[model samples]
Target: MEYMVNLEQFYGPMDLLLYLIEKNEMNIYDISIALITDQYMDYIRATEHIDLDQLGEFLVMASYLLNLKSKMLLPDPVEPSEADQESPDPREELVNKLVDYKRFKLAAELLGERLSDDYPRIFYRHGSTVLPEPESELSATPRSLHRVYVRLLQDMLAQDKYQIPQGDINVGEKMSEIEHKLKLAGRPVHFLELCHRDLGRREILALFLALLELIRLGKVTALQEKRFGEIRMVIKC
Candidate 1:
């Protein structure tokens, strides 16, 4: 009977090593390096046409296995101390690497299965031959929104140059102030209205950060009605 081996299944030397270990029903921690090396060499010789780049990696692994096998066969040198007699196994490092590789391979297989299951539910919108006009809300890009803020900051800075001689402005205090102002107004307030003439650059920045924090917390929301329009802050109901 002729035996056919599928060489394409093995990804790398570690993968091939894992397969050989499992096939022989051998413990991964106490692998028989001599037997594995001989089987690996058989596989390499059996293959007619192999990629040079891939073959190099397998050859390096084979050389390592041969060297390790030789080390295992050699008798230990005479040592005076008991601590020197309790030396670590030569296969410990290789066993650790193989264990890690096996864990990652298992995780990858799980992810691939999940992706395959969800593939059917994934929908893709087909493109139309005729292009349609974009919606008004979609027309306002982040760049335009940034420009509006920049313009507002420039106007505020041009009006006042006096720096406040105070300690670090508290973002929590600004957030409380914003909450109070929004409650009093009972409507969406303009972003610029949040800053006062007496406030310094740092104070403004702190207030802006506070607003962002509030929005992130889902307590407040910022909205732009039109393209390059005023951004309004509203307390969420």
Candidate 2:
């Protein structure tokens, strides 16, 4: 039997930096690339069968590190310019980025912890084993399974009252724009047709997630014209 390797699990340099910084528990206020670079190289060596096309960016960053390391090694014959003296340290900039990204991640984690404490697993009313109701009252109309899914979503949003972060702005706006365009056209839009418009992986991912959110909110419905035909989305009635 032969073993197969999956290189897809390794995220790039930033992922590596996040791991190191977290492992060390050192303040992002102080970062040493000299230390980071050595560990980065060790990680690279350990990774086998990395696709060249995918690995290109990491390789470029590694080459950059080597160049910077070489520059740091060269003995200075003359003092660096006054500008260089005033300028920020490259290591410091990297540290600052790690710090900022970490803050958002920390923010989400904190919110998650708050959620656990704030909401009861189940609320008790004047009954035996009652589930909590939505913050908003739902309609008593009949619904399909899909419609029920959306109603459940509307209920969750009402109960939880999600406050969309500024970072979440782009995706929401794009999704709304998509909804508007579909509405104007007055027809169901093919999912692929909607997905193709210049959304990079992140934005595209955001749109998909937003659609799911909308589906949960009873704001959209999906339809399939044929067995293998494209799926279409229309505003839920």
lDDT of 2 by residue, 1-237 (tens): 143434356566666667776677766777555776776676676667888886786677677777666655666545666546554555665666777877877887877885575755555575554456756965555557679889999999887766443354476886787778678878888777777765556777777777777778889887787998887889865
RMSD of 2: 20.1
The runs of at least 3 residues in candidate 2 whose Cα sits more than 4 Å from the true structure, single-residue gaps closed, are 1-11, 51-54, 75-87, 108-237
Candidate models: Cα lDDT each: 0.86, 0.70
Q: What is candidate 2's TM-score against the reference?
A: 0.38
For 1-237, candidate 1 gives per-residue lDDT tens digits of 155554556899999999999999999999999999999887777766778888888888989999989988888664757556677889998899999999999999977886675554445477353367777575778999999999999989976776444897899999999999998999989989987897888899999899999999999999988988887999988
When summed lDDT is taken over every stretch of 10 residues in candidate 2, the lowest stretch is 1-10
Q: Give TM per candidate.
A: 0.48, 0.38
For residue 156, model 1's alpha carbon misses the true position, in angstroms, by 37
